[model samples]
Every structure is written in structure tokens, then in C-alpha cells.
Target: MCGIFGYVGDESAGPIVYRGLETLEYRGYDSAGVALRSGGSDELTIEKRAGEVAALSVPTVPDAISAIGHTRWSTHGAPTDENAHPHTGCDDRLAIVHNGIVENYEAAKADLDEHTFTSETDTEVVAHLLERELDSLEESGPDSPPRDGSPGRPDGGTASREGESADAPDSSDVAWRVRRALESVVDRLDGSYAIAAIHERDDCIVATRNESPLVVGHGSNAAFLASDVPALVEHTREVTYLDDGDVAVLTPDSVSIYRDGRRVEPSISTVEWDADAAQKGGYDHYMRKEIHEQPTALRQALGSRVDVDTGTASLDVDFPQGYLESVEEVQFLACGTSAYAGRYAATLFESLADVRATSVTASEYAFTGGRDPWRTLAVAVTQSGETADTLSALREARGAGARTLGVTNTLGSSVTREADDALFIRAGPEIGVAATKTFASQVSTLALLAIAVGRERGTLTAATAREHLEDLTALPGAIQQVLDREEQIRAVATTFADSDAFFFVGRSYGYPVALEGALKLKEISYDHAEGFPAGELKHGPLALVTDETPVLAVLTDGAGRRESLNNVAEVQARGAPTIGVTTAGVDAGSLDVAFEVPDAGVFSPLVANVYFQLFAYHVANEKGRSIDKPRNLAKSVTVE
Candidate 1:
């Protein structure tokens, strides 16, 4: 989940990468770095810092033509300036910034010598390996035909350390030398990686993704590459999503894509979401800003699923004619917040698509036995495609010959590339470790996908689906209604902040929303809150409900479902503070406090999360835990 940025343009890559990293800082990382092929040197020069990207200290960003950068969530080493990316190798002749783990880096590192390498990071292994391989290739192939018709020199330029002349191997030669080295290095690596590099003396930047993410952003005489669109949102709307095993080289005047050593067709997709979605505006915390942004986020996500002109609601997938028809079952896999959405998706699929979709944690799905794979569809969901378990599950399912699809927010994440089909959530960048908008967007996308299946099968009528589509457009306002209540919820949160423990309960669709709310509380507030289906209260949870306990229930304006309301009354009998989220117009009689939300056509985990997140966030703020960087947690799931 590291945020990566690269640019070959008139603009300073330092400023672009720095700000872009800030936009993506919500993903959580320990260190950051950027490498530029400065005009004064033929070798790649770099600067890096531990901690936040904004904390990186650099002397100056020279008016260089190209640069590559990474904000890392550390894996192989502790968070420190020395472990940061843009790691130099081959005596600083090549620098590389990487986003994923290197499984064989140690074995690869052992094979290289005479190439001085710095840093203990697995990413450095890539640089050293690239440097050595390229050097070997150059030596074998009559020496890289001097980059740009310039004289080549040993040791990549300068006299200070390597006995190289001041006139040195030209900067252009250094760049070509580096690129050739990188191309050879690319051929050897394994595992997921989005690699960006600045070749010594080379004027252009080259990047590649193999089961990782990289996007290309367009500019007038400028180009950009970032792990996610929000990093490039400020620069351009026209972007290209790189597929797995795709290589792209970007220069100010051109961007080229290659696949299997041949020029490949690259589709440029225009991004509708812009810099505004990535910025926090005036809010002190991204959670708060994103809680408020949910209104617009919901509208946009819903907009993509439905074509107003066609009056149809569908996931943006067109399967082969016989695939969906032969599908007999579906397994929905995800972890964390996306997992909660998957639970609800299973329910929606049962009712709307008339299919039994079993929702399971990705780890179990990938490794467990006794699951039927034939005639099944594996749907994996995540805000970031780099999620390991989810990706592993998708791989296993595909190995078993199941048709697979992915619903993800990032354009070119591993999940996006690995799935037989994939759809991007338009919720933009969700910075808070606790997902707010994307959670809602994922479930909404799932619902849309459900509707799409129904439409494709003729199980759903066009008019009813069309009305659901229109109601989705109004979700922005419904979300706004919830955002407007944060100040009031802040007051409510104070009542629960002192409680020793919290219990959340819900039934039917409310169960997943309850689970997500509990997760948000656990993720940031570090609270001991747990969600249980209302039916489970009598089974065991009732023993924990006492006067000191607080009960936050998803009681959205529903008529008594017999035993469920009776269970709620049982909680009140124990004198637990019962905070209920209900429809605004409903009379929530005798409830301690009723957090009212606008009535969405269906019970939405996203909208419900907004209200619950406000309560948890305000409680966390009152309890004084850092919301942005919770203890023992980092953004981006880089480590397994």
C-alpha cells in the first residue's frame, strides 16, 4: 500500500512527488524518498527521510528533467532514513524505488559482487541486481552505444571518488547505461512490485508493474506515474492503468507501453475525480474530512454503476456469453473493512440475484479445504489491490478454474490485474486507516454488481433498477444528512467515552454495519467494542451487558422483528446506555439517543458507517488517541 510517484516533465518532480505523497499519506507508511537524474551528475542522486513524506529533508530539487519517488510502509527493516527507498546500488550508478516485497531478494543479493550497495532493504537488492546485470549485459554487448552519442567512461562520471574525468561519461550515457541495466534486472525478479527508476544520465523515467500498481498521468510536455490516481490527480485527468507484466517508459515528449517486448495498445482513461477528493480541505483530520466527503463519494460510486441514458444499473463488467450463465455459486472473499462489506454482499446476492454467495475471510478461502470451486465465481474486494490474503485467494480460485472478479478502488492494484475482471470504486483515496467512504462504496458497488447480474439474467426489471439508480444519486444528500450530525454525535460520544466496554448489535443487513462500526472503534480508538448479531445476545453476550456497558445498536426505523426488539429491550433491562441509529422520521421511543440518518433505499453499510465513525472518532478524540496514526498500525498492507 505504499504510495509511489514519478514524473518526466517541466515541473519539479520533488514538489509533485512530495505533495502527491501527502495526498496518499492516508495509506500509512514509515519512510519516504525520491531520486532525480540531476543535470550536474551522470549518476542517480537521491534524498530520503524516515517517518512522514512531509518530513523528508532535501537540499534542493534541481531543475531536473525526470524523477521517481516512494513512500514506504517498511517491511524488511525498521523505519529509518537509511532504510528508505530510491536505494542506490552499483556505486550509486542506479537508484530504484519499489512498492512491494521481494521474496527472493536475499538469494538475488548473494549473486552480486563488486557492486557496492547501501541500505538493508530488499528494494536495494533490486538496484544492486539491476546494476550488476546491466553491467554484465553492457560488457557482453559492446557497451551500450554511448547514450546520446556521448563518450562513455568507467564508473558513470566525475573524478572525486572513482578516478573518472570531470568531462566524465556523459550524463546521457549514464542514463542509457542505467536503463539497460534496469531492463535486465526486470527480467529476473519475482513477486509483486511497482518499480520506478531514474537512469544515470538518462532524461526519461522508466517503470513497470508485475502484480503491483502503476498509473500514467498526462501533461503538456510533462508526464506522471503514481501508485494511485490521487497522487496524480493534481496534474492530469487522462491516465493509463498498467496491466500486469506491462512496462512503460515516460519522457516529456512521449509515453510508451510495452508487453512481451512488443508495443502494446494502451487505453487512456479520463479521471472524473480530481485533487479535491485527495485534499482534506480545512478539516484537522482526514477521517473527519472523509466522513464529510461520503455524500459526494456515494453519488459518484452510484453514478458509475448506472447509465442514466440507458436506464440500467450494472457493474461495469461484460463477461463472456457463457460464463455467468454456467456459474452455480459464488464465494466472496475479503479482509478487514472489505470483509464486512462482503457479508452484506452475500445477503444482497441471495435476495437480489437469487444466488447463494458465501462470504469468507480470504485466508481461509485460499488455504482451507472442503470448498467447491467448480461453477463458482470468486469476488474479491479491497480498497487497495495489494491486500495479500485477498490476492492469494483470487489466485487460488483462478487456479481451481473459477471465474473471478475484483471490486477495488485503486486502478492498477494486484487484485485489479489478477482478477479475470475488475471494477474500480470511484470513492477516491480514503486516507484514514479506518475506511469510511470506500466501505460504503464497496458495498454499493457490490449491490450494483448484484443488480447487474439480475439485469443480465432478466431477473430484475429495467424500471425498478432504474429507480434504485436514481435513489443512489440522492445518496450524496443522504450522506450529507449524516455529516451534519457529527457535532451532535460528538456530544453523544462523550457519554460513551468513559464506559469500560461497548457492545454493538444488529440484525439482517444491519449486522455488517455493526461489525464495521466495531472495527472503526477498534482501529483508531483502541476500544474494546464487539459486534454480535441480535440473535446471539441470549447465547452468550447478555452476561457482558451491565450498567457500565454501552450498547450502540443499528436500529434503523424497523417494525419489531419479534425476538430482535425483545432482545433490545433485554439490553435496556440491564441499564446499558443504548444509542440507536434510526431513520430520521421514526420515533425512537425511550432510546437514550437516536442518531437519525436519511432513508437510503437499502440499508447501506457506508452511510451507517459515517454515523458510527463520527461517534467513534469523536470518542477517540475525547480519549486522545492519535486518529491519523493509531498505535501499532500503519497504512497499506505491505506485509503478509
Candidate 2:
């Protein structure tokens, strides 16, 4: 995935665009570039480089009123200066910044034999194609004006014949010409993309999207466009999300949207979080700040949705009456940390609601084995809600006649519009490439979903449901208690930072936590790590254990604590040091290092996860790793 930002305003365009790119750097950091158009000029000034946003040197263009920038995650070519975005035509009259892939770029390039290709990128073809379309229009009809300051005839001549006066075409406006050229260019291209183009003669930015995300921000005497909300939150909270085939013309005064060459109105929504939420807030890194914010994030997730007295949850999801009673299976579709959240939810659904449930990686999802679509409910879990694989799986499930629900933290994300019902996690902005707070919020929200489903199915008694509700209400405090002992976890991480490898072992609900813990360590620390069900250690993984390797065991209550402790002893027998995350009064004499967590019944393992997150953060900090933007990892996976 790549990030795109465009601005047209009274203020200097270069600085505003550069700042927006900085906020979106987590989405893509391979390269950065900007294209600026000064007032009353048709010549664009371009600056680009093959590195992070901080590496790019933005020129001071005080009078530049329009600009478009991009931070790229390379797809077609290596991250080089030649491959960086803000691609221009041979004449350099127009500049374009693109985000997604052009699947049929090879075919499109073959047709544009008259244009000289510069870089090895699918995006460059779009610029050349638009250039060619504009040139053709100037040659074939009087409906377009030549770029040079000259009055032209329908023929390739600048002067008219004797006794003949040439009249300017009605559609000779710069915006009209650019829009027509772009429409022609897009018709010849294939695949997902969010493209913003600026011409030297036009003081506006023409942007369009197909299967990729683009948001238009409305501000005082300004207009902004970005791939995500973080880039626009500072400028304006009000935004309009662009849908497929929607083209928007953004000027300093107004934004006009069109689809299929006809005007259309799009609803504008305000982002709930502000720019400060995206900052590290005084922490060493974004990952650390998000880790400590877990308590508040969990409280927001549980806000007013759960009723402890009634032993029920009102998630504001509108499913048909009697729909929960008719459900025979619950299938969760997700990827990465969200997949781990889904795995945790699957266990709770089966245990609490007495239903058959399974978690499937979204990329490998299939609705097979003769399952009845009407009786099957598919839930898609994602933090950004724009994850391509999960959206693909959701579409497949909906096409097969299954009612789908989306659980995500973003309000206007694609998942909210595509699914039949949507549940917001309300975790706020998470800027770290390695997920921390969103994972906790996803699990807490899904736990509430399980409670509601159990009550609807009549499988859980009122007192039992109330007990689970009480544990949830106490979850925020439990996580806070773990956050208070951050120094102890940091100390443990310092000792194990030099270890050859790491292993995390747990069972039941703890299994997903162990998997998520290992993911966080490997993602940020760049360490060798693996996670397994505690019982599987003896089957094959035990041979890899040694004193040089440190094993972390999740021994919290209600997550097979006794069984995991036995596995910890097995690791100790193999001469491997064991670190146990347990509750109070647990026998942890066999563990080399033990961190006590607050007791909250089944949610204790979630509290234990905070220790794992802090340990990973400290280990990466010790190794001098880039914890916020880990190498080769982008924040959101927008491409399949």
C-alpha cells in the first residue's frame, strides 16, 4: 500500500503536503515525492527521493497554490529515485501521484509507443496515457487548447486561412480538458488505484479512486485529499470518502464530485479523533504509547454497550429478529493481529454461545463443505477496515447468501459500508506499524458480541452472563495494574534481549495471546520467535529448546493454567529458562522469571498480553530496531 496527499489552499502547498506525508509515512516509507504548481503558471516543480519522508527535501514555493504528494511502498520496481512517485510526462506539464497497482500496465504501455518511458513502474503509464489523450484532443478537434500560448485550428496549424476567424472551443477550460483526459486514461487501465493529478494551468486537483481509499477534507479556504484520516485530521475533521468510479475536482473554495460524467453528492462525516491522538504523546515510540494506552482504549470499547445488570450487550448492530436463534455456525475472517483476535473470539463464541465456530485467514477463506449460507454468520475483523483480503472474503461470504458483520475501529472505512452491519471498536488512532491497542480493543468488543449471542440463543444463564459482564467491566483496571509494573517487564526484556530465540506457549484462550506476542516480537525486534499450543511443545518444538532460548508461558487463570505450567516445567527440563505470566497465588517456583497479573477470570490472559507487548518494545529498543516503522512492513495492507 502507498499513501497519497493533495492540497489546494491559500497557504504554501509544499509545506502542507510535506507535513501530510509525514503523518502518512506509516502507510508507506519506501520513497517520497511532491509536485507543486505555482499561481498563474502551467509549469510544475517536482521534488522526489528514494527514502522516507524525512529524507525528501521539499523546496520552498511560497506562491504554489496546489500540490500532490506520495509516500510509496514499492510494487512494480525497486525503491529508487527513478521509481519514486509524482511521475510526470515527457514535457513535464502535468504530474500524477498514484497508490495501487495497474494490473494491465504492460498492455497499456504497448499501445503508447509514441511516448518515451522513463521508469519501471506501472504508475508511469498513466501519466503518459493522459498526456497522449490530451495531445490527441488538441489535434483531432477544436474542443481543446494547445499547451503552448497559441490559438490553434482543427488542423496542426496555428494560423487560420484568409478571411476566417478562429473561435475558442466551449470545452477548452483546463479542468474540463484534464477531466476528459483522465476519464479516457482510466478506461484503458485496469486494477485498483487512487490517483491525484495537477496541471500547471489549473489551480485545482482532480482525483479519482477505484478499489483504493481516497478522502477529501473540507477546510477554511482550503481543500485536502489523503489516503487515510491521519493525514487530514490536522487540516480538517470533516471529510468525504470517495467511492469506486467517483472523480472529485478539489479547489480552494469547493469540492465537486462526479460519477460517470454526472454530478453526485457524497455525505461528509467528521473524524472522531484529533491529530494529537496520532502522536506518540511523550513516549519513546508509537508502539510504546499505544501499549500504555490500552487501558483507555479498552474503556472506550466497553462504553455503554454492555449492561451488567441485564447480562446483555447492545452493540447497535441491526440483525433481523430471530436471526441469532437460527444461526448454526459463526465464522470469523481476518488476517495478521486481527486474525489472532478472531481466533480468540472463535473460542469464546463456542464456549459461551454453544455454537460451532472457526477462525479462517481471510486470504484462504472458502464457503465450502455444504454449509448453509442462511444459517451461517460470517464476521470480518480488521483495524483499518480497508484490508483487501478481509474485504475480499467478506464479499465472497455475502455473495454466497450469508449475512455479514464487520468489526473494526474506523467509522467510514470500506468494511462499514460493505457489510450488512458494522461494529466500531472506538480505539482511536494507532500509528505504530506493529499493532498494540487495536488488538486489545478488538478482543474486548468481540467478547461483548459473544455475550449478546449467548443471551439471544438462551445458552447462558443470567447470573453466568452477569459474571462475565462484571469481568469485562473490571478489564480496564486489570490492564492498568499491568501497565504500572512496566519496569519489571523491561528488566526481563533486557536480560533476554541477547537470547538466540524466543518461544511462547499457552492453551485455550491463551493460545491466541501467545501467537500475538510472538508476532509483536518478530515484527519489531526482528528476533527469531515461534508460538505453539502448550501441549504441542513435546511433539516437535521441544527439540529446539535450550538454555540460550527463553520460553514465555501464559499461565493465567481460566486459560488452562495448570496444563501450561506443566509445559513450562517440560521446557525447564530441557535446560531452557522459563518466564511465566501468571495470577496471584500461582505456584511459579519453577519459573526463572515471573510477572504477576491481575485476576479477571477469562480476561486475565488479555492482561498478560500487556507484559508481552512491553517486553517486545523494550527488546526492540535495546537492539536499536525501528519499532514504529519496522523494515518491509506497512501499517495497512490495501493490496491483496
Candidate 3:
């Protein structure tokens, strides 16, 4: 995935766009660039590089009022200065920055054989296409005379030449031509994209999106555009998320949205969180701050929605009447951490709701298997709400006539618009590439959903529902208790920092936590780790156990602790040092190192996850790893 930002305002454009790119650093990019247009200028000033955004040298452009920038994660070519974004047209009058793949870029490039291509990026084809369209328009002459009373280009060529402004096109004419050219360019392209372009002769920015995210920020005497909210939170809280096939024109005064050549209006939402939420908040790393923010995040996820006394949860999800009652099965579609969270939810739903449930990896999702669409409920779980795979799976389910629900942390994300209904996790902005707080919030919110569904289906009795709700209400405090023992976790993690490999084994609900634990460690620490069901160890994985391979076991109550302990003993017998996260009063002598988890019934395993997160964080911290922006990972995956 790549990040794109654009601004048209009274202030200098270069620094504002550069700052926006910095806020999007968590999206993970290898190269960055910016293009700026000064007042009354007919040429774009472009600067780009092949490394970090901090390394990019952005020159000061006095009176510059419009700009666009990009941080690219290479897809078609290697990360090089030549491959960086803000690509220009043949005349260097138009600059464009793009995110997402152009599937037919080769065909488009071939069609424009006369245009000189400079880079190996699929995005470069769009600039050339726009140039061709503009050239055609110049050859045919303006349909209407220039509104500014300036003469048209009589030579039937590009309007401006180096050090020559005698035949420069009027600003209004240039803007009109750029808009028409962009529409033509989009028609020629296929596949997902979020594109933004600026012409030196135009005083506005033109942008569009299809299957990729683009948000327009409304500010005083200014307009802004970015791929995500974090980039615009500081400048403007009010935003309008563009829909597919919608082209947006941003000027200093207003934002004009058009679709299929007709002007349209889109709803605007105010960002609830401020810029401070995206910062580290005085922590050494975003991962650490987010890990520690779990308590507050859990509280936000719960809020007043859970009523332990009545054994009910008001999630504000507008499911159709009797929808919960008509559900014959529940299917969760997700990927990566959200997939693990779904695994946990699926198990809970089956056990508590007396319903058949399954978790499908969204990328591998299929709607077949003789399932009835009318009786099936498909739930898409994603933290960012823009995950490409999960969104695809949701669309597939909906196309099959299944009722689709989106569970996500972001407000006004693509998932919210695409799904029939949406439930917010309210976990706030998570900037860390390695997820921490969102995982906790996702599980907690899903747990609430399961409770509400079970109650509505009459499968769970009031007493059972009350007990589970009570456990959930106490979960935030239990996680805080675990957070209080950070020093102990740090010590154990440091001791095993030099271990050759790590193995995590658990049973029941803990199985998903074990998998997530291994994922966190490998993602941030760059360590070798594996996680599987505790019983499966003896089947084959036990052979990998040795003195140098430490095994971490989840031994919390109500999650098959006794059976998991037997597997712990199996690893210990192979000379593997064992660490256990268990409930208080569990036999600590059986573990080489043990972390106490507060008693919270089935939720104790979730509390134990805090220990795993701390262990992963400290280990990565000790190894001097990039804990916030892990290599080759983006915070929000906007591309498939």
C-alpha cells in the first residue's frame, strides 16, 4: 500500500504536504516525492527520492498554493529515485501521484507509443494518458472561449514552453482541460486506484478513487486530501470520504464531487480523535503506547453498551428485525490479527450461543459448501475497515444474498459504506504497524456481539449471560492488573532474548491467542516462532523442541488449562525451558517462569494476552527492532 496527500490552500503547499506524508509513515513506504505549483506559474517544481521521507529535500516554493505528495511501496519496480511518485507528463506541466495497481497499464502504455515514458511504475501511464487527452483537446481548439479572456494556443501544441509565457493557456481553460483529461484517463484505466493530479496551469487539484481510500478535508479557506484520516486530523476534523467512481475537485474555497459526469453530494463526518491520539504519547514506541492503552481502549469498546444486570448489550447495530432469530449460522471473514480474533469469537459463539460458527481467512473465502444465503450471517472483522481482502470477502457474501455486517474501529471507512450494517470498536487511531490495542478491542467487541446474539436467540439463559457480562465488565481491570506486571514480563523476555526459537502452545480459546502471540513476536522482533493447538504438538511439532527453543503456554482457567499443562510438560521433558501465563493460585512450580493472570472466568485468557504482548514488546525492544514500523508491513492494507 502507498499513501497520497494533496492540499490547495492559502498557506505554502510544500511543507503542508510533507507534514502530511510524515503522519502517514506508518503505512510503510520506501520512497517519497512532492510536486508544487506556485501562483501564476505554468511549470511544476518536483522533488523526489528513493529513501525515507526525512531524507527527501523539499525546496521552499514561495506563494505556492497547490501540491500533491506520495509515499510509495514499490509494486511494479524496485525502490529508486526514478521510480518514486509525483510522475510528470511529457511537457512537465502535469504531475500525478497514485496508489493501487493498474492491471492494464501495459496496454495503456503501448497505446501511447509516441509519449516518452520515464519510470517503470504502473502509475506513470496515467500521466501520459492525461497528456494525450489534453493534447487532443488543444488540437481541436477550446469548445468555448477562455473565461479569463486569454488567447488559446494557436500552435495546436502544449500551452507553455521554457522561459515563454506569451501563449500560456488561461487558468480556467487549463482547469477544464485537466478535468476532462482525467475523466478520459480514468475511462482508459482498469483496476483499483486512488489518484491525485495537479496541473501547473490549473489552480485546483483533481482526485478520484476506485476500491482505494481517499478522503477530502474541509477547512477554513483550504481543502485537503489524504489516503487516511491520520494525515488530515491536525489540519481539519471535518471530512468527506469519496465513493467509488467519484471524481473530486479541490480548490481553496470548496470541494466539488462528480460521478459519471454529474455532480453529486456525499455525507461528511467529523473525526472524533485528535492528532495527539496518533502520536506516541511520550512512549518510546507506538507499539508500547498502544499496548499500554488497552485498558482505556477496552473501556471504550464496552462503554455503556453492556448491561450486566439485564444480561443484554446495545451495540447500536441496525440489523433487520428478527435477523438474529433467523440466523442459522455465523461466518467470520477476516485476515491476520483480525482473523485470530475471529477464531476466538467463533469458538465463543459456538459454545455460548448453541450456534454453528466458523472463521474463514478472508483471502481464501468462498461462499459455497451448500450454505443457504438467506439463513447465513457473514461478519467482516477488520481494524482499519479498509483491508482489501476482508472487503472483497464481504462483497462476495453480500452478492450471494447473505446478510453482511462490518465490525471495525474506523468510522466512515469503506467497510461501513459497503456492508448492510456496521458496528464500531471505538478503539481510536492505532498508528503502530504491529497491532496491539485494536486486537484487544476487537475481541471484546465481538464478545459483546456474541452475547447479544445468544440472548436474542434464547440459547443463553439470563444467568449465563449475566455471568459472562460480569466477566467482560471486569476484563479492563484484569488487563490493567497484567499491565502492572510489565517489569516481570520484561525480565523473562530479556532472559529468553537470545533463544534460538520460540514455540507457543494452547488449547480451547487460548489457541488463537497463542497464534497471535507468535505473530506479534515474529512481526516485530524478526524471530522464528510457531503456534499450534497444544494437542497437536505430539503429532509432529514436538520434534522441534530442544533446550534452545523456549515454549510459552497459555494456562488460564476455562481455556483447557489442565490439558495444556500436559503439553507444557511434554516440551519441558525435551529440555525446553517453559513459560506459563496462568490464573492466580495455579501451580507455579510446574512452570520455569510464570505470569499471574487475574481471575475473570473465560476472559482470563484475554488478560493473559497482555503478558504475551508485553513479552513481545520487550523482546523486540531488547533486539533493537523497529517496533512501530515493522519492515514490509503497512498499518492499513488498501491494496489486495
Native-to-model Cα distance after best TM-score fit, residue 116 in candidate 2, in Å: 1.6
Write down the lDDT that model 1 would get: 0.75
Name the better of 1 and 3 by TM-score. Answer: 3
Give the per-residue lDDT of model 2 (tens digit) for 557-577: 867998888898888998998
Please provide, for model 1 over 1-640, each residue's C-alpha lDDT reduced to its tens digit, 9 standing for 90 to 100.
6778888887666676777777766555688888887866665668889888768864255776678888777778888889988787757766788888788888887887655656788888887777665666566443333322333334433222232222222224444455445555767777778888777766777788776667898889998998877778788989999887777778887777765544555689888777777777899888888888776777778875677555577666878886665666778889888999899888878766777688999878752455556568899987887787788888989998788899988775678767889987788777777788888888878878887786776667778677666656667787788887778989989878988888887777788888888888988888899988878888999999998888877766321234455677888998887887776676665778877777765654345667788988998999998898776565556445
- Candidate 1: worst 10 consecutive residues by lDDT? 158-167
In candidate 1 the C-alpha lDDT for residue 84 amounts to 85
Superposition TM-score, candidate 3 onto the true structure: 0.94
Q: Per-model C-alpha lDDT, please?
A: 0.75, 0.89, 0.87
Q: Give RMSD to native, each candidate.
A: 6.2, 5.1, 5.3
TM-score of each: 0.85, 0.95, 0.94
Off by over 4 Å in 3: 144-171
Query: Clash number for every model?
Result: 8, 1, 0
- For lDDT, candidate 1 versus 2, the one ahead is 2
Q: Is candidate 1 or candidate 2 better by TM-score?
A: 2
Q: lDDT, candidate 2, residue 314?
A: 82
Steric clash pairs (candidate 3): none
